[model samples]
Target chain A: MASKIRVKNLYKIFGPHPQQALKMLRSGLSKENLFKKTGHTVGVHNVSFAVQQGEIFVIMGLSGSGKSTLVRCINRLIEPTAGEIYVDEKKITRLPSQELRQLRQKKLAMVFQRFALFPHRTILQNVAYGLEIQGVKKGISENRAQAVLKTVGLKEWSAAYPDQLSGGMQQRVGLARALAVDPDILLMDEPFGALDPLIRKEMQEELMELQEKVHKTIIFITHDLDEALKLGDRIAIMKDGLIDQTGTPEEILIHPATEYVANFVTDVDRSKILRAKNIMIRPTAHVSINDGPRVALRKMKKEALSSIFVLGENRTLCGIVTVERAVEAVKNKETGLQQIVQTDIPTTTPETLIQDLIPVAAAAKVPIAVVNEKKKLLGIIVRVTVLAGLIGGGENNNNVGSSAESGNNVKESARSMDHISDPLPTSITGMG
Target chain B: MYLRSNYRDFFRACSGLIEGAVNNIEALLSFIPITVFILVLVILAWRLSGRGMAVFTLVSLFLLVSMNIWDETIRTLALVLTATFMALLSGVPLGILASRSDLTENILRPILDFMQTMPIFVYLLPAVMFFSIGVVPAVLATVVFSMPPAIRLTNLGIRQVPAEMIEAAASFGSTPLQMLFKIQLPLALPSIMAGINQCIMLSLSMVVIAAMIGAGGLGGIVYRAITRLQIGSGFEGGLGVVIIAIILDRITQSVGKESPEKKAA
Candidate 1:
C-alpha cells in the first residue's frame, strides 16, 4: 500500500536562530545541553515515519516529548526547522503558503486536546467551519455538516453552542468538525487527554468504531500507553524529541526495541495485550478420525495425557477423546474414533485476548483448542500456559517458541497427521 | 512645529475631511424627528438592555427636551458617535495587526500608553494648532483620546483567544483574515465592545474640553455656563451629558453581553 503521509529527518527547534541550534543538534549535542547553551528548545529531533493509507498511526509520549510538535510539523502548523514531509507524494515542507493552505483545507484536519469548538458559533456552524472557509455555500456546507454531526451523534446539539454540551459531547462536535472536511488525514493531539477516564474510554471505543467506518489515515497523539495500544495500528514511542521505537502494539509490548521502551511497556497490563495466539502451544498428540480408538488410546498413553484432540481431513478439529473413553471403546471393539470422541470441549480463536481467555481456560476440563476462522486446529492453550502468559516474564520466550513450533506443525500436520506432534504441551508446566 | 509648518495643507485637508464627516452625521441626526429618534433609542435599549434601560432612555431624553437642551444634546451625541466610529474604524485594524505580529505589538504598546495617559489638555493645544477650533479638531482629539482602549482591548482580546482555538482554526485551513473575522473577532467581541463603550464615554468627556475650542454642543452650554458662573444652566448641561453617557454605556454594554449563539443556548 502506498504511504499516505511520510516524514523524513524532521526537526523543529523553537527559537529565533533555529538553524544554529539545528547545527549543534546535528553535531551530537543533547536536547538539554543545547537548550542550556543556546536557549533553544528542541521540539522535534530528526523524527521520521510513514503512515500507510487508512492506518491509525499513534505517536505516544509524555508531556514535552515533542509528539504534539511532531504532528504539527506534518501540516506545517509549526514549521519544521529541517526535514522533509511528503503527503500524497507532494512535499509539504516546500509547498508555498497558498498551496500549503489548500493542502490543509483539502487533505488535513486536526482535533485538539481541549475540544476547541468555536464558542461563538452553533455546533452546526462550528462543524461547517472547514467547509465554510473552503467557500462551500452555506446551504450545502451546512447540510454536510449536519450529516457529519449525525454521524458523531450530536445532531440534536446542532443549534446549541459548545459550552452547552458536556466535555464528551463537545469532543464529539470536535470530531464532527474534523470529519466535516472529509480530509484524507487527521492530526489528533491528545484528543481524549482531558476527558475523565470513563469518558475517555467511551470516546476511544467510539473512535475505533468511527475509524472502521471512515478509514481515514489518522495520526493520533497520546500520552496514555493503553490508549496507544488500543487504537494504534502502528505506534511510534517518542522520548525527548526522538523516536525510541516504532512498531505494532504487540511487537512493542513483546519485544521493546530499547530500554526506554521496555520500561515503558513494563507497567502495561499484559493480559490485555497478549492474545490466544501469543500463548497457545502446539498440541502434543492427536489422532486422525481415520484412526481407530486403539490409535487414540495408544497416542494418549504415549504422551501420558488424559485426552487428545481428534482431527478430520485437513487437520480440522473433530473433537477430543479421553483415554478412558478410548479404552472403553477399544474394549467394546469399536473400529472408529467417532463414538468415543467428545465434541463439547471449549474452543477459542487466535485473536482472543488473555484477559478474555482466563475464564474459558479455568472452566475447561480439556485444554482449550485455538482454531482459525476455518476451524482448522492451530494449537491448544493449557491452563498452565494461560497462567504463565498472565504472569508474563520469560513467557515471551515461550511465546516465540510456541509460535515457531506452531508454524512448523501446520505444515507437518498437513503432510503427515499420523506422525507425532512434538514439544509437548506439558512443557508449559515448567513455567509454574 | 514641523507638522504645523511643513504639513499645513495636509493638516487642513484632513481637517476638512473630518469636518465634512461630522457635519454629515449631525445633519443625519437632525433629519430624524426628535420623537422618532427617542423612540428608536428606547426600542434599542429595551431589546438590548431590558425594560429599565429603555424607560431610563425615554425619561432622560424627554428631560433634555423639557430643559430645551435637546439640540445641543443631539449635537454632542453626533460628535461622540463620529469620534467612536472613526476610532473603531482605525483602531480595530491596527489591533488586528498588533495581534498578528510580535514586533507590531511591542511597538504599539508604548504608543497606546502615551495616548491614553497624556492629559486631555496637552493634546487639545495640538488639535487647535492643526485643525484650529471646530468639531473637526474636537473629533480628532477625541479619537486620539478614546482610540487607545479600542486598540489595546482588541489586541488583548485577540491575543487572549485560547491558543488551542487558534490552532483549531488554523488546522481547518482558515486563512489569516478568515481566522480574524470568524474565530478571533467573534470570540473577542465582548472585549472589543467594551473597548467601544470606553471610546464613547471618553469621547463624551472630551466633548466638554472640545467646547473650549468652539466645538458647539452641550459642551458649549456647559462651558458658557461655567465661564459666566451660571450654576443652574451648568447643572442642566451636566445632567444632559450624564444622561447621554449612561444611555450609550448601557446600550453598548448590552450589545457585548447579548451574543446570539450564547443567548440561544
Candidate 2:
C-alpha cells in the first residue's frame, strides 16, 4: 500500500499575476472571489492526493473544474504555479529538463483524451514512438509495440494509419501506445471520454481486466460520475479548482460531503451497482460436516427452519440437509449428514452484482450462497433482500447480519424518479 | 574602412565554394546535348507530376533549343538550382530557430520582410559590391532573394503542428532536438516543399535580374537584347526565359501539391 504517486500542495493559476492570485488563494479567498478581484482564472488550487501502488485513482469534475489541469501537472505537460509532485522517488516539479524527460520516459506515461496519435505514422509506428524516443532499437521497439498492440486487441490494425481507424480503434491504439513503454504510472486524461458509451463501457471493463495483469498505477481523469464509480479504486470529486471530497464509491454514494455528489449518486441504479455483499443475510442454521443427520435435524428444528447448510472445516460449504432427508437418514441409522446433504444449491461471489444474480435467484429453492474464493460461506443473499435493495428500502436491510456496514446514508437506491428531486446536499453550497 | 575590408575579406573567403558550385552546375548542364537534357527533364517531370506536364516541359525546352538559346538556358538553370540549394541550406536552420523561440521569430521576421519586399535589382548592388561582378554575385543575390519564403513557411509550418502532438512527443521524453527532427520537421515537410517551390520560382526571376552584374545565362541574353534592341534576338531570349519558367513552375508546383502522406513517414 505504498504510495506510487504523491502530489502535495498543487496549485495551477492561469493568467498573468499568478503569484499574486496564489497569495489571495492562500488567504482563504474562493475561486470566484479571486477571479472577481484580479480577473485571473484559477485552474487547480491547493489540491493534493496520493495514489497507492496499482490503484486506479479517478479525478472527476465538470468541465472547467481543472481536473484535466491536475493530471497534466503530474507529468509537467502543464506546469503548476506551485506544487510538489512525486512519481515514485523523484520530485517532478523540481527536476531539470533532462531529468524530467528521464522521469517521463522511465516512470510515467500518458494516454490522451483525444488519442493525440501521430497521424502520419502507422499505428504500430505510433505505438512504438515512446520506445523509439527512449532510444530502444528499431527492431526491438517494433516487436514490443506489436505485442502491446495485440494486448489492446489492435494487432491486425497495426499497419494502418490512426486516421484510418474508427474512434474506438484509435483509442485502442492510444492505450497500446501508453502500454508499450511499460511505465509504472499512467496519467490518463479522460482517455475514454471521447468514445461512445458502449465502447467506453467495454474499455472500462477491459481496463479493469488489464489492471489485474499490468497493475500500473493510473490517475484517470473524467467528468462522468458513473465512469468514476465503475473504474476508480477511490475517487476524488473536484470543483472550482478544489477537491470537495475523496473516498470509495460507496462512501461517495451514501455520505456525499456535498449535494452535488448526492445528486450524482441519487440517479444511479442500485440493482446494477449494488453487489451481493451489500444484501446477503448471515447464515445461522448451519452445522459442521462431522455432525450426524440427527444433529442436523435438531439444529434445523431449533432454528425453525426446514433446511440448514452443512459446512466442512474452515467453513467451506459442504451442502444442505433438508429436514425430511435428515429425518429419513436418522431413521435409516445414517451416521453422517453426507448421505442426506444436497450439493446442487446455487452459489455466487460477494462481489456479484445483484442484476447478475436475478436468474440464479429466480430458480433457487434457497437463498444463494455468497462464498469467498475458497468456497467459504461469507453470507447468504436471500431473494427478498435483493428485492428490498432494488426498491430503495434502506431501513429494510434484513437478512443474516443487521450491521448497516455499507450505507454512507446518502440515498439507498434510485427506484423511483422522485429520488432525483431529493434535496441537494447543503455542504457544497455552504462551502461556496 | 576596417569593417568594409573585413566584410570584403569574409565574402572573398566563401566565394570559391559558391564560385565552384555555380561553374560545376553550368558545365554539367551545358555538357549534355540539348536533346538529351530536354529528354531527361521530360522524364523527370513525368515522374514528379504527370504526362501532361511532361509533354509541356518537352515541347517548351525543344522550342528554347530550336531558338539557339540552349546554352544560355542551361546556364540560367544551373544558377537557379544552385541558388535554390543554398537558400534551403541556410533557410531551414533559421526556420528551426524561429519556430523554437519567440526571440528568434521576432528577430528573423523583420529581416525576412525586408529581404522579400525590396526590388530584385537593389540586391544585385550589394552582391556586386561584396564579390565583384561575376556568377558568384548573381548566384548569391539570387540566394538572398529566394530565401525568405522557405524560411518563413518553415517557421509557420513548424508552428502550425498540433499542440497535442507536441505534448505527446514531449511527454514521451523527446529532447528538443529530437522533437524538432522527428515530429516538427517531418510533419512540416509539405509546407517546406511548398516553400522550396516558391524559392525556385523567385531564384529564376532573380537569375534574369542578376544578369546585369555580368552573369552568363539566358538572363544575359535578355539583358543584351533589351540594351541593343535587336528585335528577333530579344524575342528569342524572352522565349527562353518563358520556357525555363514554365518548366520549373510545373515541376515544383506539382511537387508542392503532392499529398502530405507521400512526404511524411
Docking class of 2: acceptable
What are the Cα lDDT values of the candidates?
A: 0.87, 0.82
lDDT (10s digit) by residue, model 1, range A273-377: 778887778887889998998888777776667788999989999999887898898899999988888999899999998878766764566778999988899
- Enumerate the candidates' DockQ scores in order: 0.65, 0.43
For each candidate, what TM-score against the reference? 0.88, 0.82
lDDT of 1 at B259: 90
Best of the candidates, TM-score: 1
Candidate 2's iRMSD: 2.4
Q: Candidate 2 chain B: worst 10 consecutive residues by lDDT? A: B256-265
Give the alpha carbon lDDT tens digit for every residue of B37-105 in model 1.
999999999998889999999999999999999989988988998899999999998988998899999
For candidate 2, the lDDT comes to 0.82
Give the chain B TM-score for each candidate: 0.96, 0.92
TM-score of 1: 0.88
lDDT of 1 at B71: 87
Question: For model 2, how does the per-residue alpha-carbon lDDT over A1-432 read when each residue is reduced to its tens digit?
Answer: 557888999999998999999998889888888889999899998898999999999999999999999998998989999989887755779889989899889888999999999877899999999999999999999999999999988889888888789898898888889889999999899999999999999999999999999999999999998999889989999988889889987677656799777666666655566678866767766899999988888887776666788899999998887778988998999998777789999999988887677657545666678999999998876554444444443433332134342221112222212432232223123222
